[model samples]
Target: MDIATGAGLLAGLTVVVTIILMGGDLKAFYDTHALIVIGGGCLASTLIRFPFVAIVHGLPLGLKFAFTMRSTTSRDLVDELARLAEVARKQGPVGLEKVDTDDAFLAKGIRYVADGYDMDFIRDNLERDRDNFLMHLDEGQKIYRAIGDCAPAFGMIGTLIGMVQMFSNMSDPSKLGPFMAVALLATLYGALVANLFCLPIADKLHVKLADEETNRTLIIDGILMIRDSKSPTLVREMLLAYLPEKHRHEEGEPVPA
Candidate 1:
């Protein structure tokens, strides 16, 4: 779980409860209707905004964004590249054909090497993939941001409707507080949905994009470095520049060599 999200939720709930218990009339709130409008509105709007297939495909990606931080580092990527280089240098590109190609970033390079593609084409194509992946991430983040912006606006709309209903029967002043609370609830729900859910997801997706870009750029550098027949030691050292200083010295350590 995201510590920031967890802490913010706990703190917000505590404040809300304390405020309500101190003198705020608990009965005047319109949380249920707020729930219906925000929940139903967000669902309907998101469905309309994205294709059903894309939305379904994106469900788990979004959930992953919510729960997981991208953790693969430059050192890990450099190590894989160095190993690939060792194999290619020993037996030529044909040797790589037998290697697993499950990782998308690594698979692209392996596929290029396996297919006997020229070094220039291989580098250009893999660079294109990196660009496209980053573009996809940016586009995805925008969708979540749109939803975040809409949630609050819909909340305000719901509040207006509630006010209209309350004022229609305004002959009794006793209904004023109830209607006011209901109106306020719309803003609260909108702010909560935007802040707690949509915005956080967008932010997380951004972080993923940044980390992924770093890794893919490392892949690009490694691929080109290997294609140029740069020494494995040199390739490893260059890649380590992308990592934190702590991982640098390990680049030269022998693995029983």
Candidate 2:
């Protein structure tokens, strides 16, 4: 589990709840009409913007990725690739068939090499896979972003509706509070949902995408090197370039000619 995503969400919610409780009469903040206008309107707008299937399938999957701990790190990927390079160097590309890995991308690349595929074939297929995966991630991000964008607009719509109702019902002072509550609560809900949940989830998904891309790229390069029968040391050096300078120094020596 990703502690940062989980903890940040918990902290934000705790603060919000604390503030609401401090204000007394927390039930006063509950406005069902406001919720319907803002929540329903946001969902309707999102549905219009994206494919129904994408929203239905991608959103939950995106959230799961954001909250889940990624098992593979760049360093772990480099190490695994370096080991594969050694195996290929000693026993040739056919040796890779015995290698088992949980990483699908790595496994696919190894399979291609073990099957005697050329570099062009490997690069083309792997790049296409990378692009498709990234495209899906991008769609997921867009979904959350659309919700963030629509929530505020819907909230304002609710506020306007409430204000209009308040003016029309001015003859009765007792009904004014409900209308005003709808107006204010709608805006509050919109801000909270957009900032605390939608946008944050979108941002986290972006981070996850970046990390995945980096790891995939590293694997691609390593696979190419392995296919070429490059020395494991050289493969290590090449992959080290993907890391930060501090990490690179710790993980590898200078690349030799």
Best by TM-score: 2
Per-prediction TM-score: 0.73, 0.90
- Writing each residue's lDDT as its tens digit, candidate 1 over 123-240 gives 8898898987676666667667778988998899879977997988799888876677667898888997788777877888888788788889888888777777777888888888
CA-only RMSD, every prediction: 5.2, 2.7
lDDT over C-alpha atoms for residue 100 of model 1: 76
Q: Which stretches of candidate 1 lie over 4 Å from their true place?
A: 1-33, 39-63, 69-71, 172-182, 251-257
Q: Across residues 53-161, which tens digit of lDDT does each residue of candidate 2 receive? A: 8887678878888889767788888888999999998898889999999898889999999999999999999999998888788788889988988898888999999
Residue pairs with backbone overlap in model 2: none
Q: Pairing residues by index, what is the TM-score of model 1?
A: 0.73
| Counted clashes in each candidate structure | 0, 0
Q: Name the regions of candidate 2 deviating beyond 4 angstroms.
A: 251-257
